[model samples]
Target: MPQRRRNNRVAVSGATGFIGRALSNFLESNGYEVIRLKRQHFKSKKSQLRTLLKGCSVVINLAGAPIAARKWTPNYKKEILNSRINTTGVLVDAIKEMEPKPELFISASAVGIYDSYEVHDEFSTSYATDFLGTVCQAWEAEACKVQRIKDVRLCIVRLGVVLGNEGGAFPKMLRPFKLGLGAKLGDGHQVFPYIHLNDVLNAFWYIIQHETSSGIYNLVAPQMLSNLEITEAIKQRTKKSILPVIPEKILRMLLGEGANALLIGQKVVPDRLEKDGFTFEFPTIEAVLDDLIC
Candidate 1:
């Protein structure tokens, strides 16, 4: 573990979401003051989001609609885009309105910001027309506006699939595997870029304390494994058999265009985070599964 830095007051949006809740608790446990931004109520509008953020030195923006919570209906897609973009826009406006703006702004992004079919690093070119890609592009663009505020440090984290025991992909995957119904998807060739929940919490702390860190960093473990490899590992851990594989066409027919993004693979590595001296607690798929399963 790295040496702890000076404590600072931090404000977080989406404090109720999976990562948001975990990060808020982690920061509070580590002696940092955490303020949560909640939605406005008509009766007592005095609790404005800007007011809640007052005097905070760092702002961690994690507020966004859950992408996998629902089927990709057109209306839901609009809401998804609006939720991220609007929340970010509001945060930017609030910061601008603050008398003493936060010193550092750590915003959330997704690896989806890059082309889905190809691997991407911090310096990768933008490929913004795809569904998830466009959402991430807009979200990051909104966060970049904070740089215009003098003396403010802005960093964006492109997170991979977060694996945890609680509300995340892990639990859903675990259910089927535990029931002995688990199987690989779409030839099981798609890459699964993942990070342990503990590592993710530590990464946020590390970035917040390290003043020199800025720009986009991929918040993923060093290891990138294909879906088949992950399923096989899970089977080994659970003593289950590998069932029939779901073909890509079937998944596409069932999940629409978004299915391709899940079925296809990308071999992303966290080159920037590694160069920045951050170490992952679970750097391999087998290690991660062992921790999560057992």
Candidate 2:
């Protein structure tokens, strides 16, 4: 892929995270100076944030605890919430202090902001009350506050499940199928919205470079498949059979509320991303699985 021009100096929070690392590397390789903002030990939050963001042309916020971490205990839940909220809060506060603010603010969000087990697009209004949905809602809400600062453009990307060979939801899923233990979860009717990692990176770059882009955009592929359909597709592509579906009740008993969030499904499509002229490299699950597995 050809790189974009290095016109913007970017500051990124959560630069060490999965998507963050990928985005930072892409930006740097493309000739942008990227600075990572880390939590300070002795320095106050404001001071450290201000120092890191000074003179930056853009700020990309991808900081958040992984939602898939096991057993969402009270402490873990608090950590999940604070990690995202505090990171955005810090960045927003810092931008407010900077004399000349960054032109673009790109923040991360998840498709979970919509109702679980239902189809949603950028225009979808149905939102779930589940923990994941609430987290995404709060995360995007905090990031939106950046718009209040004059001359700042805010873009919130509501991401779907990201598929990549390196690090993401794919390897863990492949483990079960590779071991022949993989089976469809729940009723297998829930829609699973997903996107290729490369597409995600491209979308970010496009939004950052296009001055007209702003507001909430769905970062997902055109194809939306059910849990069973995805399993079958993987099975066909990998030449493996996944029978004997995993019962939803059993998953609930084992994984609790988190299991419901995972096992249940949502059919989401990127109506806005496509309409805005962004293209997907892998639109179908079969294509995605073929590329990643092979």
What TM-score does prediction 1 earn?
0.93
Cα lDDT tens digits for candidate 2, 21-135: 8889998888789997665511465676677777888889888888776667778888889988987887887888996778889999888888865678787879878888888
Model 2 vs truth, CA RMSD: 2.4
In model 1, the runs with Cα more than 4 Å from the true position are 1-7, 41-47, 126-128
Which candidate number would show the highest TM-score if scored against the true structure?
2
lDDT of 1: 0.82
Q: After superposition, how far is residue 231 of candidate 2 from its true place, in Å?
A: 0.2
In order, candidate lDDTs are 0.82, 0.82
Could you tell me every candidate's TM-score relative to the true structure? Answer: 0.93, 0.93
